[model samples]
Target: MYKILAVDDEIEILKVIDEFLTQAGFMVKIAQDAEAGLEILAKEKPDLLILDMRMPGIGGEGLLRELSRKKIDIPAIILTGYARTDAGLGFVKKDSLKILVKPVNLSILLETVNECLRGKRDGQTKDPDC
Candidate 1:
């Protein structure tokens, strides 16, 4: 099973993602904040990361930037309530497979996750359907 790490400040959202992804046969890990997420990322090394763009401190973009600085490459999906053209999104765009606006559609999230994993297995940056 593909392992997935999701970081979000919203506990309810994390619970929903965990339940859905787990039901879909993925090993899911959730962190309530970026600091916790970083720890999990280092220890678990999940196949994909589903991150919320806004949080208390060291938000999703910050986390992604830190990963880049540390040379850690992982497929990512950014979930946000903000618009696609939000200025904060510019930094992490290159590393993200998709920028999904919240509240996210679970089915679409599942499809995107599958495509990301499939692309990784095929040694591609992204799937054609992504």
Candidate 2:
């Protein structure tokens, strides 16, 4: 089972994500904000991270930048309520699999998670010649 870290300031959002991802066969961890999320990341090192762009302190973009600086390569799917213009899409790198604008469709979130897990698995399996 894939391990996932889901971070959002809203308690309901964290609960929903935990329930949905757990039902989908992932081991899910929840964090209320970016600081908590980073603490969890330090210990768990989840296979994927689901982040909310807007939070009380150390927002998603800042967390992502910190992760990058620390050389953490975990794949991420960011959730944002703000408009793309205000949020500045530049924070999301091309390597990130998805950026879901709130309110997110559950189906799309599930699909993105599956796709990211698949990509991780595929990357781990390599041809001997390559």
Against the hidden reference, what TM-scores do the models get? Answer: 0.88, 0.87
- Ten consecutive residues with minimal summed lDDT in candidate 2? 121-130
Error of 2 at 92 (Å): 5.0
Which predicted model would earn the best TM-score? 1
Q: Rate the local accuracy (lDDT) of all candidates.
A: 0.85, 0.81
lDDT of 1 at 69: 81
Please state the error at residue 68 of candidate 2 in Å: 1.0
Q: Where does model 2 exceed 4 Å of error?
A: 85-92, 123-130
Report the lDDT tens digits of candidate 1 across residue range 1-130. Answer: 8899999999999999999999999999999999899999999999999999789899887888888789787888889998772465455546455778998999999988987788767988655544
Pairs clashing in candidate 1?
Answer: none
- Which regions in candidate 1 have their CA more than 4 angstroms from the true location? 89-95, 123-130
Cα RMSD for predicted model 2: 4.2
